[model samples]
Target chain A: MSGIQDFVVLTLVKAAPLIYAALAGVVCERAGILNIALEGQLTIGAFTAVAVSFATGNPVIGLLAGVVAGALVGLLLGVAATRFGVDQIVAGTGINLLALGGAAFGLTVVFGQPGASAEVSALGVPGERGLIVGAFVAALLLHLALYRTPWGLRTRASGENPRAVRSAGIDPRNVRLIATMLGGALAGLGGVYLSLGELDLYSDGMTAGRGFIALAAVIFGRWTPFGATGAALGFGALAALQFVLQRSGVPSELMQALPYLAALAALTGIAGRARAPQADGVPYTE
Target chain B: MIRGLAIGLALALFAAAAMLLAGANPLLGFWALFRGALGGVPQISETLVQTTALLFPSLAVAFAFRAGLFNIGAEGQLVIGGLVAGVIGARLETSGLIAIPLLLIAGSAGGAAWGAIAGVLRARFGGSEVIATLMLNIVAALLANYLVVGPLHSPGVAGPETAELPHSSWLPALLPGTRLTVALLIALALAFVLRWVFARTVFGYELRAVGDAPEAARRAGINLAKTAFVTMALSGAMAGLGGATIVTGVLHRFNVSLSPGYGFIAIAVALVGDLDPLRIIIASFAFGILQSGALSMQALAHVPKDVVSFVEGLAIVALAARRFVAGRKQMTALAPE
Candidate 1:
């Protein structure tokens, strides 16, 4: 039915940001970094995108700025985790808290508002087609780059056995650092999509646990790009169903909980079988 | 200790920079912050109220951290606990003397049940507590929102919250004309008890061994599964007690925004206290001062109260930076090449 087709199309559009974030998680985790700061990265990306778009009147420029902002945070996280020997989890938590507080401050300082920013120019494309297509393309490109390229092999090797990566005359540290940065950039694109393609403005705490859910997708998909993207799309469909369920006498708040419950179910169900990178979250001594 | 001092100084400097960016005089803002938190009886009482709220969650985090598990679900546990306490307080027709203890117990029970979900998943299914707990936090939030908005919605109430608890159910106020309640004393007593447990009990020794090295702990005849489950349950109980106190002692009703990320901030408090119970008391009070002072800072300096959050984030980052520097120094000492 055309109604079902419309529903599917709408769900895919809603899933673009989550797919991007899940792919980002796959990249970082594959490089042996467990980035819990995805939430912060997404928040900062959304804030910067809207701010730039509001000032420049160009959503594309805003999108680019968002990626840059996320990458910078990633660079900080990399330095902390790889160079400084901070626990990756702690460093990620610090980043998340920092981004959260900083975004709130920016909301007041930069935008002269408290809870949210004023609306910015919307992306030119309708129905979020641009972001939807971008998500599919990224999924395909990242999958190839991860599986079919030597650099991808090195990244995966670094996560599995950093000592082996070192013996192969490559610094696993640098690879992880670059991977985390790229991951942040991808996450930024997700945030940009939320602000420019999905909504016209940014609000406080707007990402609403999407980053954590994306991490769940990475786990459910066994840390593969295509699989993670598929999980994200599945979550997106569930999210869409929540709206539909609201019309059928279900409490909206209970419906709102379905996505999170599904994530937990997925994490628990697959946890026993899923294998994580060996060196994930372990600090490199050398 | 010296490293902690250095981190403190660095955090202060970072906060000053944040204040400067907010177009306020750093010195004036800092003075206002401290003054507002400690200037008078009312100010100190407000700080103590915050300290009381933070104490149990900090202990909860520290307890789980000692067992080498990160339990980030304290927020969810707290919410569930508070909701149960509220529901009990509303429905129970007992004397205040009987109702208060019952409500607290019921809250802890609710939180323990919620936490057991993660514990079971982690213990039996090998699920990462970090991921499981994080997902559950959102679910708990949604559940709380649903209950408050649908089943428990108070008639004629303007906000999304339950009806107030009977006056008899309220915890006795410790400070007259202030929000400070017997919760502070209760928290202090629990801290002393925890200190003794960590110092003298065999369970404490097992906990330490597990945290230090699980393989060695297992080899020494410790039951990893039992310890993991018990530790998580106890941790959740602490957070639950805190949430119950917040409802019965502080708010006297369940409100959705009762906590402003106290669960997450408690992690910093635990680490800053070095996971020591007595020291956590002091650390919680210090953070309590910062939290209570943040509002005044906004009113006086026109700085966003979120600046305090920035400062808290900066503290964690500063501690991480210190560790990184120390690690490099150790490496250099070892290699010297």
Candidate 2:
């Protein structure tokens, strides 16, 4: 029972950021925007949030800065992807690489440090239990917004069949842009949680492929909010378990490799059936 | 293409800005970066030193990407390969002629097995190779850490690294006092063989066909499952050889940070080379120069060392964006056709 509780707590904590990023991914993708830039968005958000929070001595400001940073990146991606008709995957990847560049430069300018920013005072968001609960509510509400609202209808329509939606007098590009921005804002919030809650500082490449894990969540969940949330938790369990097993003096190296191995297993197991949104990587020029 | 040039230029300028912060002229910084990396025989020899560390991984990444399989696990694969080398280096008592090749083969086999595991999972279970490979990289790294630090660590050394191999077993240095070894020539030979395999062989055609469209290849009886396994295995061998080269040629023993993410950077190099082995030479030199120069940028400008890393990140972004733009244009062009 104690072991189960510990696993549950750790899993929930680990899953929170993934849930956040996956949820955001769901929104953008549903709006017919294929976003590979979530990784970059998260990195930028974490970088900005860390610098601001550390500089201002306020976590709230850091959170806001993170959102702004992510949204800015989203806006760039959206503009290029939608307006200029860039390949969605390529543009998203570019966005990620650009974020890496920006963050590296920012580290020099803002932190006067190498590799990472110095430790900062972090504001307490909900911890283990609170994160799961807050994320659940947020996911549910966002899911509702995605399905029930007028925008939701348009967004799904765009993703499912953009031509039909356009024929119905909707602008797919605009919807995709808005959705992408919204998703980026949420992912940024998740980045804040990672830095603030986990390490209380920011470092180079600190997200450590969490963005990609969230991607797996999005795919595992078939772009549904609840599905993604669940997938995040599953991956999280694997992650937390790896850490736990590492402490047992077992060849923790192998254990350390376990979560990734598990994720790989999950990816291979589900890939053929999970169809990406129709025309997901296609740029809608017209 | 022009946009890519612009982006590259913009990134180079930003790097200059970083250099300026260190109180060095950007031009001078650029000169130092180039000079320190490849100004003379010694510098060029030194660059080759780093080149050996890079060569195997680049080939590995390029090979997989050619097959449309993204093997982000090269980092992980290399780690395991190094561990294999480390383990063998500590344990083996045979002559260099036998033991060195044994260690090399062991490293290749270790990496191949690891990569094959991911490949099998993806092919047999319908998993996403990208995610699986990425995750496996971390797993491999950790497993190595555990082995060296806990189970296989040298009794003499306080660190997690294994005991050094016999002196006779170590790679013969090409230049005295330099790290460059025969691995550079071997990598080039491997690259040529890989190019031939990719272009002239039946397996090459089959792999390309599958990469172009798996369903079509399946319909045509390409045995894609086996192909994936084989490609990953080949990739692992190349990457593992890269790790062994690093150990035997440079570090002369396994240690952490031996990779410094050469595996990941290979992604960028593969792209910049357009995944062409011949083109990779130019791309490799360019990247190698930038990396070596970045050290000088750090040394002279007092800028943090990541300025080169930022450039690499920029290059990836530019390449991806360029691909996207090109794809969009092609789509439109094809649509009109």
Best by TM-score: 1
> What are the per-candidate TM-scores when only chain A is compared?
0.95, 0.91
lDDT of each: 0.82, 0.75
Model 1 C-alpha lDDT per residue in residues A1-286, reported as the tens digit of each score: 9979878987897788899899989999999888888888898889999989998999889989999998888887888888877767667777888899988988888788889999889785663687789888999999999899999999898888899999999999999999899999989889888877889899998898889889988987889999899889988887788766766887876656666676677655644567777776666667
DockQ computed for model 1 against the true two-chain complex using alpha carbons: 0.52
Q: Write the per-residue lDDT of candidate 2 for residues A1-286, one digit (tens) a residue.
A: 9989989888888888889888888888887776767888888888888889988999778878988888888887887778765556545655666677678777877887668888887766544345457678879988899888998888888887888878988788888888888888878878877777666788888877777777768877888999899888887888778777765756545543544554565555444566657755556756
Error of 1 at B248 (Å): 0.5
Instruction: Give each prediction's DockQ, rounded to 2 decimals.
Output: 0.52, 0.43
**In candidate 1 chain B, what residue range of length 10 has the lowest lDDT sum?**
B328-337
TM per candidate, chain B: 0.93, 0.91
Tell me the spans in candidate 1 whose CA falls farther than 4 Å from its real position. Answer: A270-272, B320-337
lDDT of 1 by residue, B1-337 (tens): 8988888888888888888887888888877888889999999999999998899888988888777777788888888889889877877767989999999999898888888887776666655677777778788888888888787777776776778889899999998899999999999998898899889999998887777667667779987777777888888888888889999999998887778888788877877888889999999999999999998888888888898887787676555533322321221112111
Q: Distance from true position, residue B269, model 1, in Å?
A: 0.7
After the best TM-score superposition of candidate 1, give how far the Cα of residue B176 lies from its true spot, in angstroms.
0.6
Deviation in Å, model 1, residue B268 alpha carbon: 0.8
Per-residue lDDT value at A281 in model 1:
62
